[model samples]
Target: MNPLLKKLQELTTKLDSTSETLDSFRVFHGRGKIYPGLEFVTLDYYHPVLLLTLFNQPPEHWLNENLPLLQENISQKIQTIVVQHRYAPGDPSEIVYGELPEQVFAKRGALSFHLNLAKQQNIGFFLDIEPARKWLEQQAANRRILNLFAYTCSFSVVAIAAGAEKVVNVDMSSAALNQGRANHLLNGLDKNKSQYLAENILKSWGRIKKAGPYDLVILDPPSFQKGSFDSVKDYTKLVRRLPELMPSGGLVLSCLNNPDLDDQFLLDIFNSACPQATFLFRLPAHPDFPDAESNRQLKMLVFELATG
Candidate 1:
């Protein structure tokens, strides 16, 4: 047996052991957990598919050659396997095994999202933030939500399902927002109660503020989207303006995905910008994406405004 194949077999056995605990839809994070050189993800286990993302270097011939063997070892039937090279931005995924689907439907808890396996670069949802979605559902009753950088509006759908009064989803990409609309309909939620805006977030404060003061404000942004945001600088800018949009006693869910910046980085910004706001708690990362180092993990912190 090949060395890489042997390692893959061991990982598959581990995944099977915890299949029930993972809720059918789970992520097997391999970036820093199993394989240091690449980031391997099983996007969905119930209707199986694999995503092999190369973060460190160019693709190796051996990994490609042995993918079928890896596929065969798994207990469940895998629909397809997609490979993404993070180092090469414009490059398309190399389909190493089976046929690629135009779209794959994945369910997380009660909500479901549509993923474009072959066309879109991203599968369209962040699996690591599953805990936060579950948490937000608990907090959604009778609250108006402002979701900034609302890619695919996963948070919006979860909130609406939990009885949110209204939600305004703002993002630069109209295409992504359209998918968000589809996600809402997929879950049998009313699209009329939600507003979708395709505008630049920083410059569109005039438009975004009109819909506020919101009860729940969610900020989940990309770490570095070249021209739009540089998390290190702009995240603080967004935090500084929070008081203007949120009402007294309102809640803010701030998400930071930059591996370089730790949880304290966002805490410092929140404390300095809104001293009256209380740091509630940090959302725990998904068990599937466990890490030895704390900073490398995804950070999600909830803060509440001072009512008095």
Candidate 2:
């Protein structure tokens, strides 16, 4: 068997032996650059559906040869196989095998999140951030949280489910916030306990501050969002404001996913911007998504404010 099929078979075999409810996870992380000749491909298993995403065009015979073998090997466990072409205009997903369920969700432990499998670049949930969510599950109880760049509010959902006092979710997309609201409801949590702001986070600090003084702040911004946020130039601005948002002993879960930027990029920003804060630890990257250079992967660092 080829490397791709061998990897899929190994993953599926392991998953099939697990409990009834399978946790959504990355099946193959070719984008991590750990695998030769497949750096542009990624496969994600969102329960019944397996999504194969291609960042660049593959060899002409690649799909034709592999698709049939994939179906033959894992069709029993994975009902639908969807292929997404990211290089094409308006990244589209098409079903290569089986049928799609009317509603699709990515399940993580006791949590469930709506997935936009039909369209959209990101299918509502990020599997790689499970460690951060798991961390929030343990630390969020009785504390108020401010989630910036809160796409679909996955962090908010986990926080609320873990009995957080309150959570305010801020994002530029109202549509995503709407889905976030739905996610809260989907988890059977009280949606009213959280606030959703569909506005530019940088421009709406006053409104965001109105909901604080938060006990825990989550900074999970996009690497680059045209006209809104550019990590290189804008991260310092956000880091500088951390001191004003929370009191001493307050916790901050700051995340950066820019491959070009290392952990020091954030450490220096915090040192120069919010000198009162002290570094704690960096969250480890998900094992499945292995990068040759550790610094190129997602950086989730925790910090504590030393003074009010």
lDDT of each: 0.77, 0.90
Query: Residue 239 CA error for candidate 2 (Å)?
Result: 0.9
Give candidate 1's whole-model lDDT: 0.77
- RMSD after Cα superposition, model 1: 3.2
Off by over 4 Å in 1: 1-27, 33-46
lDDT of 1 by residue, 1-308 (tens): 54345555665676667654233444345564554543543333435666666554645674656566767876555566677765566646787777776667766776788877656567788778888888899999999999999999999999999999999999999999999999999999988768999998988998999987787889998999989988997998888778888755599899999889998998899889878678989988878676767778888999998663
Clashing pairs in 2: none
What does each candidate score in C-alpha RMSD? Answer: 3.2, 1.2
lDDT of 2 by residue, 158-263 (tens): 9999999999999999999999999999999986789999999999999998888887999999999999999999999898888778865599999999999999
**Residue ranges of candidate 2 with Cα displaced over 4 Å:** none
